[model samples]
Target: MPGIHPTTYLFAARALRDFGDGFVAILLPVYLLLLGFSPLQVGIIATASLFGSALLTIAVGFLGARRNLRWLLLASASLMTATGVAMSLADDYWLLLVIAFAGTINPSAGSVSVFVPLEHAALTREVSHAERTRMFARYSLVGALASAGGALSAALPDFTTGIGLERLTSIKLMFVIYALVGIAGGLLYARIPKRGASHETSRTPALGPSRAIVLRLAALFSLDAFAGGFVVQSLLALWLFERFDLSLAQAGVFFFWSGVLSAFSFPVAAWLSRHIGLINTMVFTHIPSSVALMLAAFAPTLPLALALLLVRAALSQMDVPTRSSYVMAVVTEAERAAAASFTSVPRSLAAAASPALAGALFAASYRSWPLVICSALKIVYDVLLLMQFRHLKPPEED
Candidate 1:
């Protein structure tokens, strides 16, 4: 860690935020159930969070190039703080819905927030082009590990209830802790140099030369994200609960291991990208994982489904760090922030549209149709991505 760039601090803050999201992601659906909300309502709230993030991130993508990244990050963290506080204190359905829309309450295991592109830009600035992939791998590794810890933290209520605290009280306290983490994250972002905003200026084009490539990537990424939305970790946990009768603690354990499995793949992806190239690594690793997901849907027993899920975990996330690195490598420096935002915003929108559908699908059937649907769509995305981008290598690859 000694030679690590200052941008690693952003990764540290990301880990903190993700940890809070980890437990809360799983806890959300369960908490809603305890509050007498139907599955469809839970899906609506999740959709609201994604849709809100998409709009906010679109603004950041456009305006961020002309503004202080440090200030924007601080503001985003402040919103996280507000979100956590409001959700913990409010019980009215409409009020909770408003909070979900306005705040950064991720229902998924992944980190999708306005903070993402800003941090990507900052982290890219800190590293040489040669170091970008490795650095992103480490960034993803830290996030996955922290998220794993957070997943395990879903058991906090079990411990709290054992000590005589009310179940709802214990769950609410997790949100309070989320607020505290946001305060810490804001402080961390504050320490970032004022020069983080130095890239923003009057002369910068919003997207510069990479506009076309960014648009294409955004469209493709949206497809992948849309498939992802159908089986986001929150809804997946709910499925396991209803479909297999998994307890909260058991689901926590499952996700904790899944996160670890995914974490282990990041470095492997970085190494693999060095050999097979980013596009190849992305296309090849992704297909098998999607296949695993498809097979999981057909699994007749819980143990078989869990095994397939673990396999999918090991292969699924190899593309994440690689995809981020590839995008940064292809885009011009001036367009980095815009590219990150534009690409991610579509993903958010696509992902946002599906949870309600997934909820309805889950509500209407005992079959794991959502998983099947997720796999088929993801496979289609993989094939299309390979066909479209096979020749588009990053500069380092050339």
Candidate 2:
């Protein structure tokens, strides 16, 4: 413990955050469906939540620049935990929409999804430059495993007895549990900054550092995320239901494996990056992965289809860490947080469009179309990844 850095609290918070958010991601679609919501409506709710979370990242980045991260983190945790509690108690659709959009808490899924970069920037400020990529790789590893565990926990309902309780009730419980886990993570977060509250904090300058390139990446990220929106949970659940008659629990299992395969794939990808470069690692892995996703749409059996999904999961996320690392690597060290937000904001907004689109398609019995669109959009991103950044490399370790 003597040599260990003080900021490890972020990792613990990230792991717990992933566990809670993973559960919410699996169940929220089913929750909306039980309320008699259409696919489009379900998609809207999902998109709203996404935008809500995305908007907060800006606040976090801004606030984190001048404020103590511990205080900012604590506040984000409180807001998110409170929102999850609100989600569990709310019954009306409009109010749920309000909560979804207005919520500010940085639950694990949302936090690590966004905050890890903040963590990276923070740690980069605290540690030597030589270790940044290594730190990020470790951070991503923690999140992947935690989320995979949460995804697997989706099977819990399979063991619950009886079906008379409104499905809404069970879904609310999932939200409650997710919130509690987040609260627990927040509590644990108190321990993450091991150096204690006495540690001095400095403010970050808000001025833009590499304006043009960051915005370009953000634009491309938006395209990929917008396409991703179609396959949001309601649509994915609806996809399985219409196509394979899969129950929520069953689809949860599929998502569980999806996370599992994703969790396992990153390490291999890190290895592959050594040979092909991070940018190449992003495209080659993704092209085949996108094709597999398209094929899953036509799968004849649940097992075979699940196999395709698992394969897609394995290859698709290989780009995640590399993509993240590439963005950080490309910009000047001072601009890291802005670079993360520039790309991440558009990514969030683009994905925000999907749920509503998927829902509309479902109402028209054209839910399957979104998958095709999603695939095409993703293929474009993969191509862009290859052509745009293939020659880029990280600053070599000292």
Candidate 3:
């Protein structure tokens, strides 16, 4: 905490926004169910939100490096906050869809993929390579903890409704609350002392290698992400609702613990990377998690499903920080943004597809098929990543 003074505040604010997302990411599907949407329609809603947000991420990654990222973040947060308010006011399906499309600030805004690269580039401006990985690792730590907190916050609407708020209204209010808080965080970021964008990254780095690598990696990442997409916070909640008849509170508890498990896994991943390297760590640990996810599909009870999900969470994100770190490491500093954008765009697209596809599967009377498909495809990824990039390491700086 001693060295983390200003960074802590920023992390707190950033995490605030993430918390809103973490909470809503799980709550959205449930909100739609109350609106009387079928599973397929719910999936479309998610697809529109994510895929739309993804295209914006690409634009942000490229142009964002040239702009005031802080200002971009502030504006994006304001828009995201407004999106919540708008969604809350929307009364019907068509209106909600309009709100969804309008909520696409991530195109020119700070996002998870853009955020990691920008932050890495920022931290590098002042920090040394010896500490670079640690900074990224700490970021993972903050995000995991924040996500856990958000998942915990979702319980607020479920547990404390004595004030006579309708369940639908309470969930909407949670989104509103999180959005307003995100705006506050954005404001604080806007106030952070000045620093220019990372000039080291190229303005127009060659796209050939980065593109090829990203395409292959995206193919693999898409399979894994897409499989899980159907089970994001919202979809997972719906899955629990239908499969186990869990109330929202119970579903929240399930996600909360999953976040807990993820928080505990970040350090383990860093350490694991030392012993097995990034590729192995990503695959070995993940395959088991994917298999566990498949097992959850057949879980006889909510507790068992939660247990499997907990296992999955521990492995799900282990690859993320390392993967981000490794990808940047292997590419040119000037090309890092392109690398990030290339890979992330696909992930966003893949994530977009999962919800809709999973929803359709669920609607078609096979709710568990996505889970099974997810594990099988993930196993394929494990094999491919190791085969393709296991030996590739970044060049040492002079």
Candidate 4:
């Protein structure tokens, strides 16, 4: 740790956190179903977790400008530990719902926790304007690969059960492992050097001259996130189980491959952004992914559907690093932390509102509704984003 760069610690911590998130995104609904909860309940629980994360992220964004970010990250890591512990211990629907709401459970394919903005701000500070996009691409690459590995680990319960552990107990142990990952992440965050008092004093107020741009971007991002919530990994896994009767092990393998594709696309995105600009790369790549998702909704066979989902996976996430870099690029350095939070909070809240609706659609036997709706809304978001931001290039782009 001493020889490593500070950003390396952030990347490592991100990988650890995302590994836990990847499996949890896949296993959460299954675990809840095994505990006798319905799909609607599962959706509601996912919503609660995301909604709570939004609130916590908001608090961090406000306090982070004034406080040491290392401490904030450490605190988030602690909440993650508590979340897994509480979830593993509680079986009652109401109690589990409470844990999901108050804890750091991530029900999506990507992280939407308080840790995101904190890490983004930290990472932004460590690089030059020219290096930022590639740096973020590497960060995304690390998270994606780690998440893929975590997806593969979702099969651990099957291995444990085969060895005579009770099936339920085996599943519970996964949550225990999740708690352990949180503790490990905390250790990594502990190694990041803190900013001095002079740096703290010079920190700009949250959302100053960039307030209008941030608000507009936050609104667009919220729409995309709301659409995305319909197919958050947890709900998507539920769909696979209901539609294709996909086994848990099979889902793990499929998502692992999907994540791998997404992971490798990060650098490609960085390269593409250099040629076409960030706005073009974000919009053009995203539209194809959404189209793939929409087509997947109507696929008659599991193989075709999975193939399409994989295609979507490959292209859908190309915007992640670009978007993060773009936000940091446009805002003043003082506004970066707040910009990250402000943009992310609305996305989190909008995303939080949709899982229950998607679940209800599932409950009503409209199984493909979520996928169809998600694709449609995402396409709309892509078009709107391009139209509004195409002229507003970042400094590096200029």
Candidate 5:
């Protein structure tokens, strides 16, 4: 850790956490099915995880301004470790539900963990306004690539079964690995400086002048998150399994390629933001991706659906880095942590509401409803975002 930059520690921690999330997202539904739970139960557990993350994130946002972010990050890492350990050992429905709510299992490609707002605030402090977007892009790229690797690793269970290992034992081993990754992430986070080189203690409220803008953005983000929850990776994997009878190995391969496409798009998004501005980059790229998702829901053949899904993956995530940069750019330094938490909390809650409904639809054999609803709502969010924010450029833009 001596020669490494502090930001590098953050990047490494992100990679470890994201790798765990990526595979968990793919494996959660399958694991639940193996345990004799219905799809609705799987969706409920996913909601519990997001909802708990939102509540914890709210606490972090409020406390982050006063506490050492390094300690807070370390604490989050500890919770992640505990979550994984509990998950590996528990099979009871109620106990698993409790762990899902209290632990760090993510059912989506994007994280809603307590780590997100903390890391966003930390990353913003490490770079100047001019460099913020690209820094976030690199941060996101690291996560995406690591997630791709994790997605590929989901096939380990399939391979292990071939070697005469019990399928259930192999799946449980993945959770144990998840716990180990949390410990590894904790070690890297410990290397981060206790405070930024330019850090200063401030007693001002976490949100002041930026309160109105932050609230509005949070509302809009909530809409998008709600739409996204319907197609959270767990549910999407369920769709593939039910719709096409995809094997776990096949789903793993598809998601790995999808994650890779998303990872590479981060830099392209940074470049696109420079040319078209963050809001434009977010809106324009998003519309087409939503359209692709909608079409994929109706595609008749497996190949056609997979091809459309890959197209959606490539364009859908271009907004991620840009969105993080935009939020950080608009808020004051003191408000950065609060701003991140505030924006993310609503998004998490909104996202938490839908998975159950999507699962119910799937349970009823209306397999396409979730995807269609998700795409339509996402398109609406994109249009609304452009209308409200297109002219409200960030400080760097000015």
Candidate 6:
């Protein structure tokens, strides 16, 4: 912690943002249902939101490379603020769709906003290469823990009736809280010193020297993201609801534990990366998690399926911070933002297509095909990544 930069504030802000995302990810489909949107409609909105974020992030990655990261973060936070407020007020189907397309409402439990690349760029600059993975681990730990708290907060509706509040109103209030969190995060971004801006003096293309490596990673990451889209938290919760007759409060409890378990894996990932290297750590832990998910698809009872999901949760996210650190370690400081964005934009775009497909599958027979598909694709991605990048070690790994 002593060598850590002043960007600790950014980590806190990320936690806050992720916490908001946690509740919203669970609540969005439920809220849409309350408004008479079908499961298929929910998936459409999720895809639209992801697609819109990908476009916005693409612009930010390109233009932001030449500009100050602090301003980009502030601007993203401001948009986050407006997104919450807008969703809370809009009720028309088209209007809500438009908002979904443009807003920062992450239907998944992970971070993939324009803020991601900018924040990674800044955070990487603040740490030594040796400490980068650990720093990112702590950063992800804070996010996961806060998100657990937020997921638990979804139980608010179960209590809101005691005060005469409508269940839907209680859910809407969560978005209002999201807007407030954005305001607070903006203030944090404002604290970034002017000297902490980009290390670039020369104009750089979005990919620059790292173009080929980044593109390869991006293609693989997109396949992973596409697989991820099939079982995003919202759709997964919806699956539990339909398949097992789960209540909202019960879903909250499940997600809270899922977040906690995923969080526990971050430090473990950092430690493992120290021994086996980042790519190996990512691949070895990931295959088992995917296998757990595949097994979950065939689980006979609610408890059994839930247990498998918990197992998957414990291992699925071990790659997040390691992947981020690996990308940063390989790219030049000037290419950090571009690498982050190029890699993430494809992921967002790839993930954008699957939610609706998942919804359609659920709509048809409540089949467990999505989980099986996700598992298979993820395993393919893991194998390909390991095979391709096994020899490309970060400097710390040497």
TM-score of each: 0.97, 0.89, 0.89, 0.98, 0.98, 0.97
Report per-prediction Cα RMSD to one decimal.
1.6, 3.3, 3.4, 1.1, 1.3, 1.8
TM value for model 5: 0.98
Clashes by residue pair, model 5: none
lDDT of 4 by residue, 270-312 (tens): 9999999999999999999999999999999999999999999
- Position 94, candidate 5: lDDT: 96
What do the candidate models score in CA lDDT, each in turn? 0.90, 0.69, 0.69, 0.93, 0.92, 0.90
- lDDT of prediction 3: 0.69
Q: Tell me the tens digit of each residue's lDDT in model 3 across 93-210.
A: 8777666655732211113333444454444444454454555566677777777677667777775577777888898887678678767877767655565455553355535446
Q: Write the per-residue lDDT of candidate 6 for residues 227-254, one digit (tens) a residue.
A: 9999998899888888888998999999
Once fitted onto the true fold, the runs of candidate 2 whose alpha carbons sit more than 4 angstroms away are 1-7, 104-116, 126-131, 162-167, 194-207
Tens-place lDDT per residue, model 2, 1-398, is 35656557677777787777777776676677777876667777877877877787766655554555666667767776888899899878999888877774222233324454466565555644344545555666777778777766765665453666555676777788877876887785565453222223233354355677777778877887787777754467567877788876677677777777787787777777767777788789988988988887777788887888788888877877777777777776656665676677677766766767777877888756888888889999878866775665677521
Candidate 2, residue 53: the lDDT equals 70
lDDT tens per residue, model 1, 1-398: 35645676798898998898899899999888888898888888889989999999999998778787889999999999998998899888888889888899999869578889999988898888788999999999999999999999998887899889998888888889999989999988887777644544546787988889999999999999999999999999988988899988998999999999999899999999999999999989999999999999888899999999999999999999999999999998778888999999999999998898998887787448888888999999999999999899998888
TM-score of candidate 2 against the unseen true structure: 0.89
